[model samples]
Target: MDKFPIHIAFNFVFLRKKITGIRVHAIELFRALEEQKETKYIFHVITTKEGADILNEHGIRANGGIKVHIIASSFEKETDRLKLQLFSLNNTLKQNRIALLHCFDYLTPLQRPAYAKIIATIHDLIWLENPNTYSLPKRLFKKVFFSHSIRKADALIAVSKTSKESLIQHYGHGYDQKTTVIPNGLRNTFLTIKKQGNPERLIKGEYIIAVGRYLPHKNYERLIKAYAHCNTKAQLVIAGSDMDKSVDLQRLAQELGLNDKLLLLKNPTDAELISLISHASLFVMPSLTEGFGLPLLEAMSLSTPVLCSDIPVLKEVCENAALYFNPLSIEDMAAKITYALNSSPILQKLIENGHERVQAFSWENSAKQVMNLYDDLLLNY
Candidate 1:
């Protein structure tokens, strides 16, 4: 008998983990399905009402007669949370004859025993590498559960080669055969804003931009300190949500005497973010670690000159398209910021190269590759 076309159930167990990157991934996955008539596919976005609302706002609702499955699990403890996730997913799996189950969370495979292809995307390596990044008890539980999940997954996806290496080094004790390297893609808004170049939103080319949640790994402190010491001509506009409630970063900015220079615009809209990046003199990502820095690509796609930490993931993603700065060394960040502010010719060259580099990564391309993977699994399973 001829093989049946693959059907994917994208299990988003933790919808609040939703961010710009995940949104782009989902949209692209659906768009690719729409275009590929030979390879018939269906997407069951297993999320909550809030998650569905986010997708709807982004204009990715129920395309091609696809439906979003809203799953609810009322649990407060870590152990209970895992159990609920497993139970909810078990029900989802039994209800749908899904050929492949791809999940952003770790417990999808543990719950669904029926799927021929079980894949999980490991979006970050911090849980294994740096336990302190998470709460003590939560980290302990995650280490065990995440390790178990990886071993159980029929396939594991690492968003970047660095992320792949990190997974292998940390969790490849018995799951080496299951891992695959697939880079994340930037959203269409990135390309759209670049093409249209909305003048009203564009700055008069007087500021530098930094984007990311105010998390420790983002290293916003270093950026603020560096900006304080760097050339004074350009203001530093920091855009993103303050996911952490501490407001320690805000205090740090004030302490550095950068109160007037640092602009903290929290959780700006996509249009606002695009406008910020498109007009900035430079885009700085001082993140100490990332699975794949999507913001790096987003900024680069908008033809913004970028300066990121010289970490493996950022280097792999940005190549020579960005200026590299030492994440920990505030002095080095300061020096690079100074150079970027002072050298117009160098910055212009970086902008041009950035535009060229970003073209290589697209949501449609990523989704198509994922579909191909799904079809391959179904055919050869």
Candidate 2:
């Protein structure tokens, strides 16, 4: 029992709990870490009341190795943020005697106690890569804060090699040495596939499925156009959260004369998503950019064939388990989808490959990597 408490701060996602990824990553990571409790850990999670409430909504709370510290002020307000900087954040860190801190989602408080070492996860530089992601002022604000998080944190955690390269490309000043690549992972449930999935016939017949939030960079528009051009008879079903209602995918499908062919599913349950993916003719991810493609793994874990963009991050995650297409070209995407559907031998190989690929990732494995990082930081200290 080489146990000695090491305090680390985490909890950054202000999740609408939109999809499993956001909540699963934020809480499940810690849960995974806690399960690997042979190594000493006392997670001093500093989050807003709302953030704490969000965790509560998911039916989790403080456990033996997990300690929740509520920040009295709101993270969303400007004045309250300043107050967090000048008083709330510093006091919280000092009072906890936090030796190490882990910041998630590029959200970091600039102020910290002198003894506290910081580690921040660079999820994705999406705002910078994706145009029209934010207004000029908001972009400027992100630039100011994100740069600080990059420069200030003692160790940076990039979810993929692409993200690490992007960080260096933007903030190149020998920052790469301190940055470590630790990929996000799926829960254990994904690893074990149960055949009983589609209970309600929530979606009748076979469909090609895509799951992600409705973001411009996700390239849903191109996906829709590709499906319209696609020769396959299977319907195109895009399942995202209710938040995507603003994007009005229905209108795009209607314009493409795919109103009958395209189905938009809002906030499907875990069982439903698994059923949808497991039962799909193919699972497509047409994102222009991604930090890491967890959905690809989810789709794969269910023995579903995957056809996704040839982008670096997705490539890094999927390797040879899936088919690839140019996300920007509707013609290529359509051709790939149609070709994938008709190619029985290739699809069978993909399903077999998917079963093998998913075994490489798990929450427990991710936790062990993080614990190793924490142990190294302590030994060096």
Candidate 3:
């Protein structure tokens, strides 16, 4: 029998701004899938002009068997943009004969072609888990739309087991049956790129690094306070996109008398980030909650000792590879940072374990599992 043509359509309409975890997951996963010679599936990406431009900027071009479809739309208003994408997506999927539609972001189109199976990847349930991070209106919108999208999906992929459990707890036990845990993987660049010197000179001397957007869940203020309490000369480098929260963090740093010690790099490029993490004394993830901590793996791949919050998902991701600190306790965080910086034995052990832990996660493996899931779903139909 002739092999079936499995044309997978990935919806990237939600990616309008700077690159985030969700956008990275989609791009890296697609790239991995493209490299799979065993599975002859034609990949089609549906993204906005801005998203397409960003891909192009990263040298992610459509060639080989992969194709890119740009959807021109206005992003002035959230609701209006979503509406435009939904209407346009329905037409595009039909015209392109999309066999399966994968929504990289949590939400999916309310109306889709009947012939295509829809798969939605849920990175986190921040709105439901930590309501304080989002406004009431935005939370309500996500609750409604996300619930609908999950219910409509033919299958759901969770980035971590914590996320899958969260879905079951909030969305009910039915989700447990359909949801599969396929953790996110590092981009090939992160795995193969050589450690380059800090070209920007962002760090003066020994420094600790943390990466995340300026969100309350990221707990940057607490991380700063902990750093101030630690007696190390190492600087605290917080690198992420500057949302409005950065101003508040700067104010907090001043209040804590850590203005001189805290360095905020707003949205560093991938190469710059690699350089920063590669040379760091330690990489810390102070997030209160995460679906999966990708940076921990990135830091580990770089052979940087890891220190992170003692949260369930972090524990699941880091396993025995990192030194844990109580996220809510400044003293605990401080002590852990001090130990990680001063103790060479602990640091060396962590680096060794980190490299071993990181080997289990690869985009190639992740893509193969996703492709197998697609095949299983198609066979059932």
Query: Which candidate number maximizes TM-score?
Result: 3
In the range 1-381, model 1's lDDT, one tens digit per residue, is 224544567765454433655555555555555566353556667766666666677565665646578775333444654665566666776676666787764565466645447887777777666555678887877777787778778787777888778877876546566777767777766666667755355555489899877667888877888888886778888887764463776798778887777778867878888888878888999988887888888888777899999999998998989999899999999999898878989998898888888877876677677666666667764
Structure candidate 3, residue pairs in collision = none
- TM per candidate comes to 0.90, 0.90, 0.94
In candidate 2, position 134 carries an lDDT of 59
Q: Please tell me which model should have the higher lDDT, number 1 or number 3.
A: 3
Tens digits of lDDT, candidate 2, 60-160: 56877778887663566654654454345667778877778776667577678888888878878887898575577777878888888777888888878
**Models, CA RMSD each:** 2.9, 3.1, 2.3
Error of 3 at 312 (Å): 0.8
Candidate 3, 260-287: lDDT as tens digits: 8888888888888988998899999989
**Candidate 3 — worst ten consecutive residues by lDDT sum?**
194-203
Clashes of 1: 0
lDDT of each: 0.73, 0.78, 0.85
